[model samples]
Target: MSSTRTGLLLVCLAGVLWGTGGLALEILRDHSPLSVLMVSAYRMLVAALALLVASVVLRRGPRLLALVRAYPGRSVAVGLGTAAYQALYFGSVTTAGVTVATVVSLGLAPVLLAVVDLVRARHRTVTRGTLRLALVLGAALSGLVLVSAASGSGAAVGTRPVVGLLLAVACGCVYAATTALGSTVLTSADADPLALTTVATTAGAVGLVPVALVGGGPFVTSDPVALGTLGYLGLFTMALAYGLFYTGLRTTRSGAAVVATLLEPVTAAVAAAVVLGERLGLAGVIGSVLILTAVAGLDEPGA
Candidate 1:
């Protein structure tokens, strides 16, 4: 496969791992007393530790340290961005319905990144290709709204309605910013993707420590299943998924990268149907197809 195809596959694989992570989180929630914040903290902490160990074993510890020293601000920004998106996403889901939160965050993020790219281009003007890309993204987002709204079973909306929209938008912005900054750090600092992932994830873990402690300590549970799921999330979802994501970002545009990751929600929807025995309604099926089509369209040259 070509380098571009390799990048696309890496991103798609990351999305799939993320879907499994969502499933693991749902299972953990049902099986334990851990709150979402606690699970997030544990996932980050464990993933960070695992990546740190890997870096040392692979003899990338010095490189990691060099990146940290050279791009301290970028490292902090990436970590904070990760924490911000996660917190904001949860807040949006709580404040709005899951359907609204999912659609708004997932749909807006790629658009935001695309806009950022347009703004950053010094000489490249928005051309026919940009317009076409916009239309594809719009179609995908509409389908996402249909799928997400119809998939839910009438959850209660929070009293403060506008807060949810704001949170979701913020989540999208943070996602875009972090993605662009992450790519910059990777290229400018010539950092190892896995080591950078460790640093950024560790920062996120540290940021969430306060919330995790206040929410409740002992994030780990005695249940074997829950422990196993947590390990999967840390090792596979965070460590492996983010590593691939960063690696792909080396060869992919940030906007295109976000578009590729839209597969994450699609994967989750399919996993829910197959693993949890939930049925995908007609809209859900159509929505999944539209998203896949949009991602596929992105594979064309110059897309």
Candidate 2:
């Protein structure tokens, strides 16, 4: 198979792995004392630790440290964004159903990125494509409003639907910011994606430690299920999925990779419906469709 096709498959696998994240968090909420913030912290910590161990085993410790020293500011920014993304996303899932949280957070990021790019390129001549982009943004916003305003009987336990939607939007914004910032570092001639990810993940864990301490109580859990779930989250969702995504990006067009990542929300929605019994109302479903459509449309070939 062509490298591009292999990259597509890898990205799709990453998305599917990400789709399971919300459900896993939900399971932890039921079986463990860890709050959303604590879960986020632990996930980052474990992933970072795993990466560190691997770097040592592969004799890349010096190279990883050099990368961190070379791009301190970018590394910190990426870490902050990563922490914000995880905290907001997990909070959304805790308050909203998996379907809503996944759709809003994952769906909004690409549109946000496209808008940022357009603003940055304001000096360029406006064209029909620019107008189309505006239309897509409008549709996305309208959909967001619909989803946020939706009220029905299908909400998850303790669902604060509106708040959840807002958190999801915030998650998307953070995700977009981090992606843009990380891209700048990743595109450098001598960039090592794995080392970069390790630094960011480790920094994120350190940054969130205080929040987890202050906001989350009974942080230690002896539940085997919870412990295992957290391990799965760190190892599979954050570490493995991120590794696959960066590796795939080496061979795939950025736009194509973005489109392939849309599988995340689709898989999340299906899993929520089948495994978690979280149903979406008509308005919520419509909003999800609009958001996904806009995000996909905003992704251009070379993006």
Best by TM-score: 1
Instruction: Give Cα-based local distance difference scores for all models.
Output: 0.83, 0.73
Which lDDT value does model 2 have at 208? 86
**Candidate 2 deviant stretches above 4 angstroms:** 1-9, 91-105, 116-153, 156-169, 249-260, 277-303
The sequence of per-residue lDDT tens digits that candidate 2 reaches over residues 53-144 is 88889888887888788898997788888898888887887787655776678668767776666666673877776777666666666655
- The lDDT of model 1 is 0.83
Give the lowest summed-lDDT range of ten residues in model 1.
150-159
TM-score of 2: 0.75
> Which predicted model would earn the best lDDT?
1
Q: Report clashes for each candidate as comma-separated counts.
A: 0, 0
lDDT of 1 by residue, 30-111 (tens): 8888888888888888898899899989999898898889998898789879987988988898888787788888888888
